[model samples]
Target chain A: MATGDIPQGGDTIAVIGGGLIGTSWSALFMAHGYDVVLQEPAKAAWPAVPERIATALRQIAELAPDLPAAGQLRLTTSLEDAVEKAVWVQENAPENVPLKRAIYAAVEAAAPAGAMIASSTSSLVWSELSAAMGDPARLITAHPFNPPHLMPLVELFGPDPDRLETAAAFYRGLGRTPVFLQREAVGHIANRLSSALWREAVSMVAEGIASVENIDAALVHGPGLRWSVVGAHMAYHLGGGSGGIGHYLSHLGPSQERRWQDLGNPALDRATQDKLISGVGAEARGRGIDELEAARDRALIAAQLALSGQRP
Target chain B: MATGDIPQGGDTIAVIGGGLIGTSWSALFMAHGYDVVLQEPAKAAWPAVPERIATALRQIAELAPDLPAAGQLRLTTSLEDAVEKAVWVQENAPENVPLKRAIYAAVEAAAPAGAMIASSTSSLVWSELSAAMGDPARLITAHPFNPPHLMPLVELFGPDPDRLETAAAFYRGLGRTPVFLQREAVGHIANRLSSALWREAVSMVAEGIASVENIDAALVHGPGLRWSVVGAHMAYHLGGGSGGIGHYLSHLGPSQERRWQDLGNPALDRATQDKLISGVGAEARGRGIDELEAARDRALIAAQLALSGQRP
Candidate 1:
């Protein structure tokens, strides 16, 4: 646990916080056969963590039936006991600067010297989080997609190449695709693109070009399916016919720019927000959040299972 | 063929142009039991048409095993012969306005007066194309996604509700999802959102935030997978946790706007184009367009088949 080498299977890793993301991350780690010491101060939330992680583990097991036996999970209320002998620590506290800095101070004091501390932060950047850390180089921002256990993307950014590569290798071993940023950017790669798409989506609703149901339907049935197989750049590359993306840029670049120029920049004013809430409500058709999340997880598993055997 | 009612199964539908889109449309129509009259001005494109369509049909057949017996296909060089007896004329000419206008004139001259004339034009708006048409009310822009047979989206826009409704019903009968636009937008609904997403995607690469491979990998593994099951609005809806999109807009709307503001407006300059060509080439890993397209089609079919039995 005290080795400087990258943590591998059977290594004891500390997973701090027992919220949804923490539980999901712990499930992913345990399913991959790594011992997890989960720490959470709120004893009330501790009882539900096991069943939640077990459900997530079951979902992953369905897709990958040949996984190694799960590792041991020890729950604790004391942060020091959780990170005492750990070689890696994954912190999933809420995104508050003062609160996270306090946890990091606690972790640095108790965790083993060579252990890598990773932050599962989606919105906050590494600079802001690392500014208050004792050994700033020890912490790396590893932002997993929402519902971390089901989705495979983990965006990693830090100053140390060795640590980044170590984390990248570790994630890849666990069937996660880790995308590294050369420099820190707000929202990173995937969220930026998604936000841009949603902006235009909101504008379309606000302008009444199409209803929420139609737009959502169009996406699920159309480009969204293709996106599941290829990213935006590669989609256009294939769209260029036999000529590839070069041909697309040469011939269709003007048209793409025109479309970009025409794209809307609607503000999230009260009226626009009202339209969004109502529009998505109609699209939901009375499905509650739990039902919707269940449906989404099921579809994600099925779709990934479907695409698993095929090449990307 | 001359009836004003919507075209149903066993009816003759003319699929003009023997290119990929046209041939895929023919496959979809024929697979659903509609007799097809495919017209290609160049006889050089003739011998390859049927085989291409048969391949696409086979892909669809793998997913849907209980399809009706395919309708008869009659290929001809004469435009008049192709549309003379058809009740639904689906035109797939190139995007040249004058050429499309000419084809429309000829289609109007020969096809049944009451037949719905649907244009598979992706970018061109209804007003622009309808201006020169003999019966503008008959022409509805029914733009299908690329590889139309596999993709389910068919964006429909027309002035006349009866014609639009008829087209929508016919598409629905063929197991296609037809999303109607309340007003015509330049790139319609799906493509505009896609374009917006790509602008940010391209900017990420151009600004050296990440390599194209990582950015694409992030997307395919993360948001793209979620998107395939749910659309942007609905995904955000679910992201609001138990509170739904109402809570999301109220709580996270400010951050979303901040991300949107930081989204890039990258130009497809010479240098950027070179980066794209090289980057996608690396992503392709020496596979040609044919290989990529085949892989994309296989993934699409498999993914669709996977999600077919599951509720969305």
Candidate 2:
């Protein structure tokens, strides 16, 4: 199957590091018919990669079943061997700067000159990740939300505009949503927004405004549902009554600003931490971790399907 | 069908100020087999009430098909007639303080002694709404998300704990999820969290970190999906592996705090408003308001069904 940017038969992709992110990326790449070469130095982690990849593939099948059959999976311990014939290298090594630098240095030596190098780092900026690279033009930040194969967002940002475009095209070819950041920012787009919202949520609990259960319920039933379809901007756009966002700004924006000023910024002190821990326990309702995780996954898949109009 | 708190069959419910919120409340009450009396002073709005109720009931049927067949709907221009025999009164008057006070005063004089008078005001606190009432015990805040029949959250906050419990039971009887606030706060539980998140989202777009389209996609594809299933606290709890939220706080709480500090507090000034308007126009791709609204309603209903495991 021909796809954007890739060759008619698809390209050979190197997935360095066989942890959760690495395995999920490998599954997505292979499911889209890209030959995946996964390298893990830790012998113990290598055995788990295929199992995790299989689980991820099952999920991808449910969310996007029309894609072509998966390509072959090649496992290797040698980083040099993994990148020998690859067209793209997705580095998911440990978050340590020094460790990432060493891995990139090794990839630069062995991978083809035209191969685009992307880092799945959530914390570090592109400049920091590509500092040690001899040719940093090809290195870009392509951060994905957790469970990469399911979540469609792959936030991309970097200096080289051409490589960034190529990275975006590559991700799009794999049936993913690639959002390009105009510049570097801490926590990128999603995490920054998530952290901001969570801070206020934590403050609400700490201040005795509402219980943790009610907070979560309030979100899931209210803005969270609307957000799944239209997002914040468009939600406001519709709120403006056909005049669009400009009307909303002139009328309701002041109320939003007032709420922001009143929003809490509570510290994660010992007292707050205990409150949150106990609150979550009560909300969990005796459900085990595995049960809750499965429920979340099912709910996420259901949401994706519903948004796509695949289900009634 | 007998349900909690109400009479053996169903209680006579009054829906005052038949605007959007009142009509929605009427549809929800009628669908749950409760006799509903809806009051609207504006005669022009009365003609459209039936059509709006029919639309809302259709959506409700899809989301909660187990609900009993709808009871009768009675529309009236007289506030006295509407609340005369009601066992519960949901006041949905416009957000004007004086108008709400007058409506409550009339409701207080006409409604049955045991009737629970609740305000569906999103902005005003319980005290402010009940300030003009002689008996404020039954006058509580029972704010529901827009399209009340579809969205399950009914935020209940009031000075009377027993009445709040009764309100919760009544909403639960209607197959709605009622979240009880420990105390009164502006915007209640959901809107406050929503405003906090949107403030950051707007700041990101205004600062040029990303485009409006990308910001919306970042949320709908990222945290929005997770939020549909679990709230922020549980999300962090799961992120902590087996140790729960305490471990997450001990390890990653500092990073969250740092991200919070970096979050933007952007004002909705004129320039920012223009940028957002054009951004939304570009994202809309020429879809009209009615089309977009229908799409939102469909997606919301699908998400509700998916979460309840009613869909494959």
Candidate 3:
């Protein structure tokens, strides 16, 4: 795991596709004192990146008071220019394999030999995304949660373990917790769990067992609070009382299977989709997306601060 | 809705088990200034109840100051004596149908007719638990998360909504969040969602996609934080950006379905169980169950206090 291996000749970090995720990655890099070159071909959208990043930097600053002055943020429309002087490229492109492959091929040509192109992909995996990369080992899938500047999870997976470790160490230096995948899987780890959980949550709503509002409330009030402190596995470990998860499995494993069998596999058909849309609307309580996002950011920061000592 | 309707002739709340749940519920009832008659036939456990309740009360008090001096706590070995002067009964017996049924029948025979007997059974649904009750409507399933006094969820469901409302109002007055199920479902709301999430989480471990520690860390730092603020459904809505969940469902729904299909349905075979047990052991990082529990409680309190205003 060597930061020394980073191409010193190309001293800047290139962030491709300056959308929300790219903007967030830009803020995160800047907050940690790395000069970021962000590329967005959408000329109208480029104007919002700086201010969005500034807001994110302030939010990061609130959680971390002693952050250094942000690195200089550079915007570009050309992918060639963005990766020209890149020691590392954090690509936040859309989930299109062909476009991503083209960007990677182009990046490999323009960027320094040692520069790592990390994708901010949530849905796609490494094999498909890196199939077209000239140097596949140099391309790593670094998937950050929404608002990358705030959320500290970067799911890293690539062919090179040493490179992944190096990336993980660098993220750790920035106060991020990076989890490595032994192998690639769809949605990575967290999102798979999220989808599985939401499937049942949506099922409860569609089945009329509970309302969407109540289900969400139940989560935030109950298991959500627990998860913020401990993960699902550890929660059950602790839940198994003094005997730990072994006791839980030996004693309560049967009941868990029964519940799993009973869990709904409701399709996201039109009626279910409509129910979900309206339910989310009710849960929003007339608050628009902006307001809800603000509240979520606020709560995330406060929770992270409070759990700093206890974070896994 | 009708606290006044509680049988005034019997001026105490009967807690018909002295296990962990009973102890927590006893502390909660006593913390709210209700005299509690705790009945645990095991004389060996009687002495520990007071100290356990005291510990739970202090935990509750830490989250909320200005709490009144705790009400009286009387431990009894006989269920008849415990409920003889009970206005309401909160039964926390083990999840054995015959045992719980017998307790409910005995409580009904001795206690006032208007008393609402609430069961804190997590696994058994209302129908199974209340099958033998003379007045089935009088039996409400009030399932609380572990360490009941601290975690604020109380899932309420019964035959009658009015009675459930009364229970909900009472729980609210006690600073607990009560979520009602329009209909009974196995595992209620939070636990069902919890089971769904854990199944995927365990699959990741069993499949060696990630270590137990990394999976747990991913959760605490990522979706867990988001869930603490919102919920699985609302997180997607927010993730959809300005278009909300409707946009998310329309645009990302296919990807979600793909991921869901890819989700592993691993059985908890002995080998998988062994992996989980050892995985949790590694994740515990030499912390004993007691130490882990203290950390969990500490984090839970901090998170709750931090998000008190944001709580649903």
Candidate 4:
């Protein structure tokens, strides 16, 4: 359970399922100097995983250029071979329950008992995923936000506290921000909060209150920028002036509650869905997915560096 | 009614209040090269307004360095004298209804007939504030997020379409992002969406689901970063792959609805308030309010530059 006991640069780690998430995780592990063994069941994906990993590593280099050289990348088609000698196993299979269960079973059976097992699943609860495993205590949920190599969040939750602590230490050593959940939840922490905000955002558009471009602009220029530095609670605490959250709650909490009650809950019916698609298309303004994604990644890097007090 | 007809730089603007918001507005107007006449009823704030405006102008200079030379800052105690011959007036008085009504009434009597009057009110709707005004057509609500000099959002709504258009043009001329609301709502667009997200964030903490530091980290590292680049609607559109938002709604909308139902609605009772204060204190980690505010401003400046394609 000690931080130093976890795998380091010289150690080997297994990355099961070499899709976007898996490849990004591979890049991160390799960048941290851990030899990565990548396994992908999809035959077509085998041809592109290396290129994706390379792109991810380039992004990592831009974000943190001082890291040690990346370790070797070992590609394998067999899960057992990938996990056999790895000190840590990171499963990034599709979100299908049965597929994840089978993968976990294979990993538990093939990998060493002391090998730390983690999942990149965003939606499923750990208890459900571990139902079929014999030693589920070793398995933990280490859900990273999309583009795992860049985003610092890695939400860790598990049945055993010791394993969770071990997983936390491992992620921390890799220079990632790992948050531990007290219990299992549907979307964990970040996605759940995202869903809450998105629900209201979509409702505003569906109700014809504002256009898609305006809503997005409001966020990027308004609360979204603040949220990047402080959480909602802390923002309110600061808004309370010298008294902090206590004064804010006493004076402004009622208004917040009133606003919450008045919040929209528009259903995503066919008409609403059409409006959203068209609105987003207008906002896209001829920018393709690749261009938008690149812009997002660049902005994220700049914001991250700025948050850490580094001049971008 | 046309954008060209609206006042531009070098035009005189009357700022009716000299608090935090009013000072920020004055800084922005001055930075944009508009002569600003600041009127503060509280004599105690008159001496500090100049210092606050200086700080805000410095921050604005960091965000936008190519602006014209700042206009003259005229200090006065009489609202009538401030608005007598000004082409535009920005009211940032307290949130009380009657005080705003009286201020508007006085502004209408003293200001020129064509002067565009705007309120920096965060909560009250325009119709309520203009109920007693003889010329409500010229009065509008132009709500800005905190630190108006740095944040680029300005929510504009009014009874007159032409007036709203004029206000939009004016804010755009000042290099600010202006969102027009189709109708009035409590907390406007940004605050409402912020409250929705904060409700779930507070619920998670009050329910013992996660700690304050962990929740804030999850947001700053996860969705908050994405939000600075794209709004929720566009993010979901991109998340849907090639088919866009329609596909995402049909496939994942149900799960979003489920999450919305599961979202919490926690009250700010005494115990909850205390927990929030303690949590924020721990997160602050001995950093005072001034330090946190400075950090937030720095991150915001970096984010704004990155979003605009400038290398910070």
Measured against the true two-chain complex, the DockQ scores of the candidates, in the order shown, are 0.85, 0.62, 0.78, 0.61
- Residue-level lDDT tens digits of model 2 in A1-312: 111144323678999999989999999999989899999998988778888899889998998889898988999999999999888889999888999888889998998877778899998898888887898877889999987888888999988776777777778877778998998888899998889889889999999999998898888878777777778888878777767777778888888888889999899999998899899999999987777876777778877887774211
Question: What lDDT would candidate 1 get against the real structure?
Answer: 0.90
- Model 4: per-residue Cα lDDT at residue A221: 77
**Tens digit per residue, CA lDDT, model 4, B100-144:** 999989998888888889999999998899999997777889999
Top candidate, metric lDDT: 1
User: Which regions in candidate 2 have their CA more than 4 angstroms from the true location?
Assistant: A1-4, A7-10, A309-312, B1-4, B7-10, B309-312
Point out the higher-scoring one by TM-score: 3 or 4.
Answer: 3
- Taking the tens digit of each residue's C-alpha lDDT, what string does model 3 give over A1-312? 133363332257899988899998888888888888899989999778888998999999999989887788888899999989778889988888999999999998888777788998888889998887677888889999888888989999999987887788778877888998889887888888899999999899899999898999899989988898899999999888889899999999987887788888888999999999998888888989888888888888888888888654
Each model's lDDT: 0.90, 0.84, 0.87, 0.85
Score candidate 4 by lDDT: 0.85
lDDT (10s digit) by residue, model 1, range B1-312: 543487878989999899989999999999988999999999999999999989988987986778999999999999999999898999998887898889889988888888888999988999999898877988999999998999989999999987788888889888888999999998898899899999998898899998888888888898888888999999998888788899999899998888889899999889888888899999999999999889989999989988875746
Q: What TM-score would chain B receive for each of the candidates shown?
A: 0.96, 0.95, 0.96, 0.97
The runs of at least 3 residues in candidate 1 whose Cα sits more than 4 Å from the true structure, single-residue gaps closed, are A2-4, B2-4
Report fnat in order of the candidates. Answer: 0.90, 0.74, 0.83, 0.69
Find the candidate with the highest DockQ and give its number.
Answer: 1
Candidate 1 local Cα displacement, residue A16, angstroms:
1.8
Residue pairs clashing in model 4 are none
RMSD of each: 1.6, 2.7, 2.1, 2.3
Error of 2 at B31 (Å): 1.8
